[model samples]
Target: MRQQLASMLREARHAAGMTIDQVAAHLLCSPAKISRMETGRRPASQRDVRDLCDHYSVDTEKREQMMALAQDGRRRSWWDEYELPRGYSNLIGMEAAASSMRDFKSSTINGLLQTEEYAREVISSYFLPANPALIDQLVAVRMERQRAVLRRDPLPDMQFVLDEAALRRVVGGPVVMEEQLGRLLAITSELPSATIQVLSLRRGAHAAMDTTFTVLDFPPGTPLKPVVHVEDVFGDMKLERQEDVDNARQVFQRAADAALSPGESRELLEEIRAQYEREQPPER
Candidate 1:
């Protein structure tokens, strides 16, 4: 709801032909505050919403809606339990609400497909020299998201395209990678909505090679807008414009087309898992 409100408020401001400074002046707040509020970076207060609504001469019905949105922003969510970076929290929140999603991961297994052991290694490495407790919390959050999004009924129209390098990478060592690969193989049968494809090395240099991204689609008739999410060194970015979503979708289609079919992906996963199995030392 916070995101929805943010979009609505931003659109309303444009419709009213007011600048951020203008709204900030009316709300008696900083321009940065108004900017953040419109971008979902800062939560808008009741007074902020009411003052802005009145300044724009908004209709009573619309004012009520914006007020309700401000209040809705305060409501607790499942991801709120864990203290997480705002971007990641928002990503998970959006993921939960999405009715369909496309995930294109280049370096590691998609979070939804990671095993607990694999996740631990990935998290531990990302936040190196960090607290074990924080690692546990982060891992716990991922596991919960997996169950909530993937291990349930009425699953999202999910499509995951894993680069061949991701499959071959020895993340968390041989055992963990093997288990993670096994999970990928099992997921196709476990969840009918999910389709896993492998972007083969044979297809060298695809459209999404430069970066890893995801496009999440919200259900129709919802205020929530579909967003194209990109994760880079700087952090994650959420692109909600229609053109951005369209471009991301086009890139995904090319990558998907270049990828191995579901059955072929399973075969490749099996081959990799077997290699990892062989690499395991002799039992005591």
Candidate 2:
């Protein structure tokens, strides 16, 4: 929200026909500092807002409002209380608001695509003597998040690259895994804006290793920069540095290049389903 407020403040300043250098001179700061504050690259300090109000002749009420917004923007989100297993509540919140997303998963179904059964099995393994009711609530939340995948108008364009190992993991036994793979194929086949690519084992020791990350890209010039979410043993982290984000983007491209085309991936999934069926005895 800080970033959002900064963008709004910058727009207001721009509309007033003021340049960053001019504002800097009026506030007795460098152009870079003004630029950072306006772009949300730097947090808006109380003094900075006060100085800007003095320079721009903003009314006391308006100045106080902006200061309050800046304060609220820096405060952590309330979702941190959920204590998500992978500590992905923050990332989920961001993804829920993104205009587009590029995800690379190396060892499991992307969270959005995991079947309820598969998800339950995965989460069950994570929490010992797990509370069934809590697991159900978490699953519901996960399912709620899946709504993003089905959104039609103004839906966030999604690009997913999954490693072959993810497909072969057998998360919830063959039947469950087969159903999950079929669901994945079906979604990609039906959603024109969604793309799914499977990175084959043949690619070997690629940029993605046994790791997963997502790059959430918003509209250009927005206060929030494209961020990379990296999931680790401890928790998930949001990476915002330009260089790191750029590197993640490059790695995603490489992984996508190595993955099977969408059409081929769907076909491969079907073949695996057939193999699973062949190994199972007839029902009664």
Candidate 3:
């Protein structure tokens, strides 16, 4: 597979009438980098694929395939052997390729929505034995996944419905929780493609009460089926069956309906943030 990709890169480069040195100069990288990408020694980055496609004047279809191949290379990550925990790599891959995503978390803040401090606290609490380097790597990976929320065209439309209690639970203490809530509001306000809804405790229990899950929607003409990721401590359940997927979709819809709207959710966060502030005594 790598060889085929390498051959494609070389073919595209040759067709453009551009020398390796020129391409390397355009990319602002070493000649060896281009050589390795063409030889399959290193997987192509999305930027590399885009630049080459433009230089080669490839059609949309061919360009999309090459870029998708580059993305797929990252999906089969080698991070598993490092004991990075189960299901995380799968989550990253799903987030990377999903055209739309809906998440309902009844417990702590979802990793995708967490601030670095909140994430660090959560990781440390769960992986008590992990060293600083591993913790830092895990946090970095989580932040990288969050970038999906900001990507341009072909970016996923993200909707998150969090239980209101989750907002006030103080996952990493009042300071971290406050920062997280503020970050959530700021992100949603800035990203028109994203939505954050809060499922208030007063609304009573709903379909997403017992468990947390995510539904990932794919772009049109995608080869694989749409999947639902039901997360648990042991491992996650990847549901691809039509019936199961439908059921999860229905659950998410109901939860969204019960949750506060984007505007109201922001107001809710502001209120919580203020309340936490009031409860915190001023430093001497």
> What are the lDDT scores of the predictions, listed in order?
0.86, 0.77, 0.79
Judged by lDDT relative to the true structure, which candidate is superior, 2 or 3?
3
> How well does candidate 1 match the true structure, expressed as C-alpha RMSD?
2.0
lDDT of model 3, residue 68: 79
The clash count for each model shown is: 0, 0, 0
Query: In candidate 1, which residue pairs get closer than 3 Å at backbone N, Cα or C atoms, i.e. clash?
Result: none
Error of 1 at 76 (Å): 1.7
Candidate 1 local lDDT, 165-245, one digit each (tens): 988888878888888888888898888899999999989889999879889988886667889989875788888889999
The candidate, 1 or 2, that scores higher on lDDT is 1
Query: Candidate 2's residue-wise lDDT over 20-81, tens digit each?
Result: 98887877778999877765556787777777777677777767778887887667544434
Ranking by TM-score: 1, 2, 3
Candidate 3 lDDT, 171-224, residue by residue in tens: 777777778888998888777877899999999978889989999886775543
Which structure is stronger by TM-score: 1 or 2?
Answer: 1
Q: Please state every model's RMSD to the true fold in angstroms.
A: 2.0, 7.2, 10.9
